[model samples]
Target: MLTNRQRNHIDVPTLTAVLVLMVLSLGVVYSASASWAYEKFGTSSRLLNSHLIKVLLGIGAMFVGMMLPYKIYQRLTKPALIAALVFLGITLVLGGEMKGATRWLHFGGMSFQPSEFAKFALLFHLCALVSTKQELMKDFKRGFIPVMIWVGLVSVFVLAQPNFSAGVMILALSIVVLYVGCARLSHLFLAAAAMLPVIAVYVLMAPYRRERIMMFLDGHSNGKPNYQLLQGIIGFGNGGLFGVGPGESRQRDFFLPESYGDFVFSIVGEEYGLIGTVLFMGLFLFIMLRGFRIAKYAQDDFGRLLALAITSTVTLYALVNASVALGILPTTGQPMPFVSYGGSSLIFSSFAIGVLLNISAFTDMHPREQKHGGQLSEAATRAAASDFGETSARPRPEGFVELSRDARPEGSVEPLNRAAGRQAGVGTVY
Candidate 1:
């Protein structure tokens, strides 16, 4: 529902970061895809034009997400999850194969990967539950079981598609969001241990996956299975500290497969060298920090958790992709967020950024808000205000007591005044 004109409230800093990344993505995609596109389609502009269109569409999707109130996401959580489940199921049954994996569902003239939407849908549901059921989160039976059912439901279909990397991403994202949501750490550890065997079996059942793992562990031996990894490393090594120069990467000329998609980071390294890659990573780090800042000052619990989940997911994907490209991890077909030439990844990332900026817009970081000399901390005041009516004359919630703001900077985590809550016998409402 959000239109560009109405999205003035979008967080300018985060928006700036996203725009810069998108520009960089455009440049990289153009450079990285030229050779591959020219060879495949007999026209150098084919992939570049398609990438440009996807970028524009992604920007539009971002603005739409920014225009809508994030609270709407909470309402849509259940239906969105259900829809994703159905779509993933349909993809598993009837989807055509790409790269030996049935991960995309093709329609008349278009295609979509359901897992992309499902990722965000699942995160939205997790945030909604975490925000609404804070107290219950500490209990394994009541908290962990119900939430993880959705995680499992999504993961089963993703793994069934044999998209092992995406399956791992979904499970990892769920675990991280749950941890951030305050699920018991011990239970999480136990759950992870229990999952190891299942994960092993899943990996071994597929020869390619097992080979990938083995290659990852011992890439030095012959380097046959790790041809892609070796080629990527060679690209980076060729760049050295300064790089070979933008749009001049030799690796894109068929030496490294999928250079414009999953291995785009190698293109970045080969072209820009270590300095460029470092600066690129710094941008992602900036986004991560800015996102967490917005989460810290979010208007409510839902906003806080939602922002964190979205931020974590984006940063995690970027990090993992870069790691794989650098040979720090196994090849995982995970695309570099904004830098990769993938419509699904780009659009989903843009949408997440849009929601994050919206949340940031509602945060209380403005000088005017800080000028109000009330002793109550911003978070306590906001939460309590929501609990009671906005009007001060409304009866205060029973046992409610305001706590003074900590002397920390804006968007820093303030220690919960648990003593005050204990004295009030409310046992930490927010």
Candidate 2:
């Protein structure tokens, strides 16, 4: 049980990032969704209102996640992983398909994406497993094989849904966790080699996938696949150095499809400009650095693994999102952490931040000290006395007496008059 003082020692860098991103997201989402809202609901504020509600709900979920003891996650890891897999299966059976991908489960009016939660749950389980098997990680059979099988199962299911981007993200995330967990470099290299042919086949079999790669590498000749990329680039160009100003983006007005989802960065660049984009990039880098620092200084193996898993997951997602926005990779439906307009992504991001905060609580740079007000005051007083060259001239409390140099014997260097005290039957005085 962490005391209040102990809990306060937890660094909130991730939380700070979350707050900044949320504010930016809310403003941009409002602007990006306004035109669509007006067309659908006959009111421009409808999307903004709904997004505000989602933000409030996400914040509430974050509060719960951050307040829960990190140890509780250990107990819940197995169950959570199972539940995530079950939900993923359910999504395949009854999920809603959007843009030809079955990623969301719709119940009544609410749609939930299981993949978002699955990422976190998989992280939790992997961390727990790796922490317990540090020695085994170096062994191919006990460590690499099991983890690969586990990830492969999930990947097969995700790819079966034809959500190639999600599958790729999951595979990347698992590889990162394995690397951080100290799997042999040779094993990773071998695995990478093995994956190449499969990746080639997958790409060759899917015409759109292959087209995306070609368009990404060569720029579309007919500007068919490059339309979104060109629009995104134009958004950034229009803003110039400072920006066109918030809510003034011409691109978000039906010019950039799904501007509020994966390409929210375009809206950001269009509205906030080059400066804003740089700032956003800087914030994400700072967050990744902070999370790595937390993982590096975590107190125990479990904490270290947990921190690494969370940090890697967030970092990978951010990189993929940026790559997609920059047209270095095909655009996927992955949302920018905290900056995209989606309930599941936002909630999962908050949860990941919460885990990072939990790891921060146990860092060694801030050691646990006595927290009673009186004890702290006493320690401070003693420190101040030492600083001021004060001498102990008065009698002190029985258990709190201060020893003097002169209390030693004349010919001996012993500070305590042990011999004299023993002779006097008063026990050794110190």
In terms of lDDT, the best-performing candidate is: 1
lDDT of 1 by residue, 342-395 (tens): 888889889988899888766544322333476765644664564454635233
Where model 1 places Cα greater than 4 Å from the true spot, the runs are 1-9, 220-225, 368-430
Clashing pairs in 2: none
Model 1 per-residue lDDT at 15: 85
* lDDT accuracy of residue 147 in candidate 1: 82
Give the per-residue Cα lDDT of candidate 1 at 237.
Answer: 97
- Candidate 2, residues 128-157, lDDT tens digits: the string is 666555445557886678777767767777
Q: What's each prediction's TM-score?
A: 0.85, 0.83
